[model samples]
Target: MTLLSALFRNQEEVMTFHSRVKLSAYDRDLGLFIVANRDDKPSIKPLRPYQMLVLTTKVKVSDTRKWVEEVFKYRGNTELLQQFMEWEIPKFPVSGHMLKENGVPGGKRIGLVLNKLKEHWADSDFTASSEDLLKQIPTVLSELDIPITR
Candidate 1:
């Protein structure tokens, strides 16, 4: 069976998805990132683990359904939503929770949070501080057992 299938079949495995911080026009700052789940075991030949793609674009009025479809397309093997609630969100720093858990800050979760923030901002009595918005994203990125600038 493929690694994807195996990983799926065994749900208890702890697999890490790695990404290199690179440049991209997709976001204004922090650059765009490419995430590689180590379990995929992509080969050097054509059609790499790049087999699947999930793209999340921001929208103002409503939740983007595309995020739901795309995430499931590539993430069916992993219980992504469950992990979001269980591990990713609760364990990470609050700011990182929304970003990493929901695939936001860089993916769909960012959009979702932004939408909520907008709603809260619209309320005259509920105003969040700027620091509140920047709370989760660490100014420094920790990886490879080292600290690097984010």
Candidate 2:
């Protein structure tokens, strides 16, 4: 199965990610989008490429409505989905299988490194190239204590 299948796109799994996903809430301390629960407790999932795909794709309609209705002092013209528009979202330049091909093993750790690289890519204003992202895998593997093979 692809990353979309095994990881992100499970409807029952990621939840209505919009309900928890605070796209507007970027934590300066962590440099990540913060996710808060109904009780106001913080929780986070690794923002793997697939999870991002799932989140972005699903977040549009309902969240637009919520922002339209609830959020206060909003600067936008209107908070309606009918007026929704998407600016450029940078496509992440790498994937789990790409990591595998580069000798990073499978499973949860793939997600961990992908999340790291995604952050790095986004932090670069999406200018980071695939080769730049891929080169980090070895270092990331080492950080995860996965021994690198020749």
Q: Which candidate number has the best TM-score?
A: 2
**What lDDT tens digits, residue by residue, belong to model 1 across residues 32-109?**
111223234445521112221211233321122223323334445345434322421111113544445433335444
RMSD of each: 16.4, 12.8
Which predicted model would earn the best lDDT?
2
Please give each candidate's TM-score: 0.20, 0.46
Question: For each candidate, what is the lDDT?
Answer: 0.31, 0.48
Q: How many residue pairs of model 2 clash at the backbone?
A: 0
Tens digits of lDDT, candidate 2, 1-150? 111122333344334442465423311111111111111222253222322332233345344334322211122224321223333345678987788888876787777778777766765657899999898888777777886543
* Candidate 1 collision pairs: 95-136, 104-110
Model 2's lDDT to the true fold?
0.48
RMSD of 1: 16.4
